[model samples]
Target: MADIVDTAVSAGSFTSLVAAVQAAGLVDTLKGPGPFTVFAPTDDAFAKLPAGTVEALFNDIPQLTKILTYHVVSGKVMAADVVKLTSAKTVEGSEVKIDASNGVKINDATVTAADVVADNGVIHVIDSVLLPA
Candidate 1:
């Protein structure tokens, strides 16, 4: 299997997300040998943001990196394990709330798809992009 970066790129729906990851200079990190659990958002989800938000972020590398890393957890946490947790600490050094009482939610985003395995980790498709506190 490909790594997380390749996996997302191949998914096709994550164009905006993949670009953001690249702009943030995190391509190497995501492509590294780490079992990261990424709550990946689709291009449509990014469109949910107000106009100019994405552009503004792209100009701010630090903020973009923070927001991007906020979508990731340090280890590979599968959907089954994620459902059992109330929260998980993000690689950005913040905690994201997890609510599995219904489907699976990471903060305000709903998990649309789950357990997309990669060589370096897993991907859980979220309906919204996650932001840091």
Candidate 2:
């Protein structure tokens, strides 16, 4: 099995996300040994951002990294586990609200796909880009 980075690349729907990860210089970290749970946003999600938002983020590595890391949790928390949580602290150092009462939502994004297992972690595809406050 491939790592989180490779798994995302193969998914083919996260082109913008993959590029942002690379641009933010977090490729190695995602590829490293981790029990990470990534709330991955698809290219469509990134596209939903305002014009030039992505481009501007690419030039700001620190901001990009924070935004990217906000999608990750330290442990491999799968779908079942995620539903049980009201909140989870992200690697970015902020807590994301989780709501399972009505489907599963991570912050404002809905979970479109869940439990995409990777060698180093799990990936849960979300419909919107989650930004840290």
lDDT of 2 at 123: 99
Report model 2's TM-score to 2 decimal places.
Answer: 0.99
Q: Which stretches of candidate 2 lie over 4 Å from their true place?
A: none
Worst 10 residues of 2 by lDDT: 17-26
Candidate 1 segments exceeding 4 Å error: none
State the number of backbone clashes in model 2: 0
**Clashes by residue pair, model 1:** none
Q: Give a tens-digit lDDT track for model 2, residues 1-133.
A: 9999999999999999999999988999999999899999999999999999999999899999999999999999999999999999999999999999999999999999999999999999999999999
lDDT of each: 0.95, 0.96
Best by lDDT: 2
Clashing residue pairs in candidate 2 (N, C-alpha, C atoms within 3 angstroms): none
